[model samples]
Target: MNAINITSTEILSDSWYTLKKISFEITANDGTKSTQEREAYDRGNGATILLYNRSNKTVVLTRQFRMPTFINGNETGYLIESCAGLLDKDNAEDCIKKETEEETGFRIDKVQKVFEAYMSPGSVTEIVYFFTAEYTNEMKVHEGGGLIEENEHIEVLELPFGKAIDMITTGEIKDGKTIMLLQHALINKLMG
Candidate 1:
């Protein structure tokens, strides 16, 4: 296999997040080779899950404040998104399960892997694991709104699947992962 040789990786920032500048020699598709340098943001990998109930015709979601959106264009900084979090030290499934409960207050037992994607490939190195799970009223055990210590003040939202899907067109939901999961559900006929 052809390989891209990494010559050097220099740390540019080491605060809340990490940024590294690297020089690498890459081979083009036409068999040409050249050296390039670029900075990459390493926030680590994460997982996202969409909880849906076929019988109830509804899905679970979360609303939270994202500073990046506010700075970019949103005035309130609030976003409607799927339950997600960084993988930390656990595997994708485990991380998604823990995040689902912590942020939405629902403990899920079984989850099926839907897909995996790289949300941002230009500068950030984050590979996200996408999943969907079936849930019922019996699965909810706690009042979920995220952890105070983690500074997560999330709001749990259980909306009709159809309505939530329509939200995408109306611009109510803006998160990428949420959009993908919603479309997946529609295309896969996850709802009854």
Candidate 2:
């Protein structure tokens, strides 16, 4: 991997936060030098949190329309996922906290950092910070459905932890980050 040298990077499009691009490269590993163009979308890193209710054995999630998914094949594009948002300026932790409240109506005191992963390494340059937190009825401070002005018409969902896990295999939940967080909770016996 270190043997590869990126000769140049060209931006093909930057209409969205995701920018498309191409690059030329040379590799010493295979003693090959070639001009290859590829896309690299960098929208900055993001954070996702799964709020679990130990007593109720439920997990809070959100549903929102994703244009990319709509065009790709999902007619509805209403993805069921954990509370998430881009870390525009704040750090990952702070970003998740704000997002959790805005997207799920739950104010989390402490979020456990579980892991980090790249959504799509082939093209997207976004890494997602995964988190877990416990939710109580007392945490409800507002009715969250995302920012309307931001065009985020989100639907908050609180389903049994087991049911949420089942959604993964049943083809209901397709978001990668959401899947990982749910699996983490089940595998770690986070539910009381």
Best by lDDT: 1
* Model 2 lDDT per residue over 1-192, tens place: 636556677767667775766566756566766667788888899999999999999999999999899999998978998899999999999999999998888888898999999989998899999999999989998989998888888899999888999899999999989999998988899994
Q: Which pairs clash inside model 1? A: none
Candidate 1 residue spans exceeding 4 A from truth: 1-3, 29-32
lDDT of each: 0.95, 0.88
Q: Which candidate is the best by TM-score?
A: 1
- Give lDDT tens digits, candidate 1, residues 1-192: 456999999999999789999999998777889999999999999999999999999999999999999999998999999999999899999999999999998999889999999998999999999999999999898989999999889999999999999999998999999999999999999996
Q: Mark the regions of model 2 whose C-alpha exceeds 4 Å error after superposition.
A: none
Angstrom error at residue 7, model 2: 2.3
Please report how far candidate 2 places residue 19 from its true position, in Å.
Answer: 1.8
Reference-based TM-score of each model = 0.95, 0.94
Clashes of each: 0, 0
Scored by lDDT, model 1 comes in at 0.95
